[model samples]
Target: MKQIVARGALAGLLAGVVAALVSVLIVERPMRAALVIEDARPAAPGARGGDLFSRPTQVVGGMVAAVVVAVLIGIVFAVVYRWVAERVHRQSAFARSLHLAAVGFAAIVLLPMVKYPGNPPGVGDPDTVDQRTNMYLSLIAAGLVLAVLAHWAYRALAKRNWPGPMRGVVAAGGAIVLAGVALAVWPANPDPIPPDVPAALLWQWRLASLFELAALWAALGVGFGLLVDSSARRWAAGQRAAVAPT
Candidate 1:
């Protein structure tokens, strides 16, 4: 039990650091570029650059904050992985991890719409509507993709010993369904006019962020799963060694 917990925590911490770095590289950088272009093109731009890129110092600070948050999140995820591995029935740790991740992704997609702050709603009268819808649509697509990928991964791992076409079908099906649902449910956002930033951009960034998170979740799941499995195998080997005697 202690070994599993320790492994999970270590894996989670590693995943968090990697994930934060990936987000900074892939999502933040591009978002910054988009913001810069948008700000430069504006007829009368506000003091705040429309992009995260305009402020390099701020961006770095944001990245640091993100890294810290990711680390904490990683630890929590690790603990959950250990608990689930120990208590789950029938399904392997991999399967449980993937399924839980899918659920987490889905919740993230729905967050802007259903959560406390509500959606961005753009800068319109209905401050919640446009932002909320835009966020939902963008995240839903990404969330579905993540779900499918994770599910297929789980299926593949669960049935690792299986042979031939059966395994292929199972894996493919899992991936497809996981991605399809979220995309289908996503709602589109209206383009923001001059002086007003487009909701689509916000949604796009959010969507990309979700993908970054999905990658982290996948890594953590795989890493923690392998660790737990390895620990169990080692323990079994030790028991065999003891019973056989010197």
Candidate 2:
């Protein structure tokens, strides 16, 4: 069925591409520059993890690796999105798809730039900085495109009133993202810099970068109308009523 496909394969692919792209363009580049490697050489002994920081044998290797990771992360997101979107609001397949994409773009692409401190030339290159900034803008545009189009499509699918408990999920999603952004933009020094990280400063920057990832999906709930405004309005009314007591 269409729902099955959306919940499984299609969702996975979308999440993978967005997550990987965001990781590469925004997170990966900044982390790379921060490391200050003199040469783009192969990893040596003690470079064990083969993480994002690992120097690639070929461009293809890096690309493939990124895609694989993106896909895996995307699959997880697909399930989560479907559960919440369906249970809370009964958003259609297309709407959920767009919402996932937007969330990925915002979290991966936009949030990084918002959260991180600029690393100037001595600290980092202008080209790298510019690329990261441009990438963020592109992701934001992509998210808006997804949101608008999906919203249009969503008009046709089943929709729910969204219960009181569900609104908590939406608010939580927003808070998580905001927290991640705050950490990356102003990261604390991580205890042990991962080996691929060439320097101490790079390690610190990456520490901040990793934490910001939490917000990627969280932002989606806020932007995509996953929350229940009714409760908020009611609470405000209650406050006013209490204040008007004789």
Candidate 3:
């Protein structure tokens, strides 16, 4: 168990580094270009850039933050894998890791994003920032809870000898229905973009943000699988050596 944890942590760190690179090279570069266009748009006499840091500083800081977030997420993936390994039937580590990653992406990214899509800087109203933040957080919390309930429902049904397809259908359908209800109850975020802002820039920035997340999750899944596979192979080799007559 200790070895597994250590390996998982190492895998997560490496994966995080890769993810950070992807964000910096692929996502941030394009996003910065889009932001420049946004900044060039005319502003009122008293207007100023609504940034805490200069563009270069923001880019470097964002890369660092991405790496840190990826590392933490990797550790979480390790812990989750450990917990699920014992409870679930034996399966290839890659398959299990991928499955977990898919569920995680759905719960953490896809669902919340559907309700509160990402926006570029200067795209939200300052007056309602607090409200928007709270609403987004609530959506994330609700999505996570629904994901857990769906998992539980699937397990419960499986234990009762329910058909596998039927169990999956019920679990998935229930979660979707619950999520729909939540979405209906939640207040929509008001559009904050002024008439002069370019819609193309906003769209590009939002798409880049989503791409960054997709890259991070993909790295986590693939990296975890490779680590687990390598570890298993080494363990098997050691076992074989121990049994061999010297």
Candidate 4:
């Protein structure tokens, strides 16, 4: 268990580093371009820059933060892998890791994002930050709850003698409907973008943000699976050697 966790963490660290680089290269460059446009606008009297540090400093700081966050997420992934090992019947470490990562991306990213999508900097009203933050967090929590319920529903329905594909279809369909209902009931966020902000820039920035997250998950899933599989093979070889007549 300890070894598994260590390997997972190492994989996560690597993934995070890769993600940070992606952000710096692909995401941040466009963001800075947008910021240049924003800075050209006339500021309200007494309006000041958000950060004390310069752009380069912030970029480096963001990379460091991304790595730290990735390590933490890796630990969580390790723990989840252990938990899922008991409940799921995946035959290989890679399969199990991929499954978990897919489910995670759905629950954590896709679901909530449908309701409250990502926005680029300067897109949101500062006054509504608290309200938006609360709503976003609530949606994420609700999405996770729905994911858990969906898994439980699948398990419960599996106990019945229904055909496998049929059961999956029914379970997944029900979950999707429930998620849709949840989204429908939730209040929509107001469009907070100023008229001066280019729609094209906003669209591209949002896409970049989503891509950054996708990259992180993809890297973590594949990297962790490789590490776990390699470790398992080594352990099996050691065990076989110990048991062999020598």
Candidate 5:
């Protein structure tokens, strides 16, 4: 287990590097454009370039943040991987990892993003920032609960010997319905987008952000899965050799 966790961290480190590169290459475009808009606005007396940090500093910080967050996430993945080892029921460790990552992405990233979409510079209403943040956080917790419910629903069906297809469909459908209802009931963002920040540009930024997150999750899943699969293979080979007559 210790070895597995170490490998998971290593995989996460690599995955972070991949995510960082994607952010630098793809996300930079829209982000820079947003910055341009931000610069044109009247700067508050104390603001530096109308922001706390320069672009270069922000870029570097973003990369480092990505790596650090990925490593932590990797550790969590290792722990969760152990917890779900038997429950996932997938033949391949890789498949199990991918499955868990998909659920995590949906439960954490995708859902919150839908509820409180990220904005680029000069986009958000500063007065409502606190409210927006609070709502976003609550939604994230709700999403996790929703994920647990969906998984539990699937488990209940499995215990009853329901077919795999039926179990998945039912669980997924229930989750979607619940999510849709919640979204409809939730308060919309109180901030009207600044007219200066074009919708097209905002969407491009959003898409880029989503793509980066998706890439991060995908890389983490694939990297950790491969590492686990490799470890299992080596363990099996060693056991076979140990048991064989010389």
Candidate 6:
């Protein structure tokens, strides 16, 4: 378990660095475009506007934030992998890691974005920040609940001797339905997009952000699975060596 966790952390660290690079390369262009709108706003009408740090500093901070968040997610992934090992016993380590990563992305990123897509900085109204935060949190928590139920649905179907492919489709479909239901039930963000924020730029930034996050999770999952699989093979070989007669 300890070794698995260490591997997870290492994978996450590497993945985070990759994500940060993606942010700079892919996400930053759209973000800079949005910042142009911000600069033109009446309140802050200059190049250096609306923050303590310049764009360079903000970019560095964003990279650091990505690394920290990835490490935390890696720790959580390791813990969850332990919990779900029995449920995914037949899958290879790589497959299991990827399946879990998809679940994490769906619950934490996709579901919430269905209703309240992300905005680059300087887009939202300041007055309703609290309301927006609460709404986003509520959706994230609800999405997690739906994921749990989907897992339960898979287990229940398995007991009834359902085919593996059928079980997976059913579980995934049920989760999607539940997410839609949550979107219907949950309140929308109180704050609307500002008039100045262009829809094209908004979506561009959002797509980049989504892709960056998905990349982070994908990298971690693959790296962690490879490390774990290699470790397991080594341990198995050692066990065989121990039992062999001299």
lDDT of 3 by residue, 100-142 (tens): 7877887888877888888776577778888998888888899
User: What would the per-residue lDDT of candidate 4 be over residues 135-204, giving only the tens digit for each residue?
Assistant: 8888778877887787788778778866767867887788789889989988889766788778888788
Model 5 per-residue lDDT tens digits across residues 12-99: 8988998999999999999999988987888778765445778899999999999999998898888888888868765589888888
Off by over 4 Å in 5: 45-52, 231-246
* Tens digit per residue, CA lDDT, model 6, 120-162: 9887777888888899988999988988999999999999999
Residue 239's lDDT in candidate 6: 89
Model 3 residue pairs with clashes: none
**Model 3 off-target regions past 4 Å?**
41-54, 230-246
The predicted structure with the larger TM-score, 3 or 6, is 6
Where does model 4 exceed 4 Å of error? 49-51, 231-246
In candidate 1, residue 68 scores what lDDT? Answer: 62
Please identify model 6 stretches exceeding 4 Å from their true place: 44-50, 231-246
Residue 164, candidate 5: Cα error in Å is 1.1
Residue 19 error, candidate 2, Å: 8.2
TM-score of each: 0.50, 0.36, 0.82, 0.87, 0.88, 0.88
Candidate 2 residue runs with Cα over 4 Å from true position: 1-11, 14-37, 40-56, 117-246
State the C-alpha lDDT per candidate. 0.58, 0.47, 0.79, 0.82, 0.87, 0.86
TM-score head-to-head 1 vs 4, winner: 4
Q: Which candidate, 4 or 5, has the higher lDDT?
A: 5
Candidate 5 residue pairs that clash: none
Q: Which 10-residue window of candidate 3 scores lowest in summed lDDT? A: 29-38
Clashes of each: 4, 4, 0, 0, 0, 0
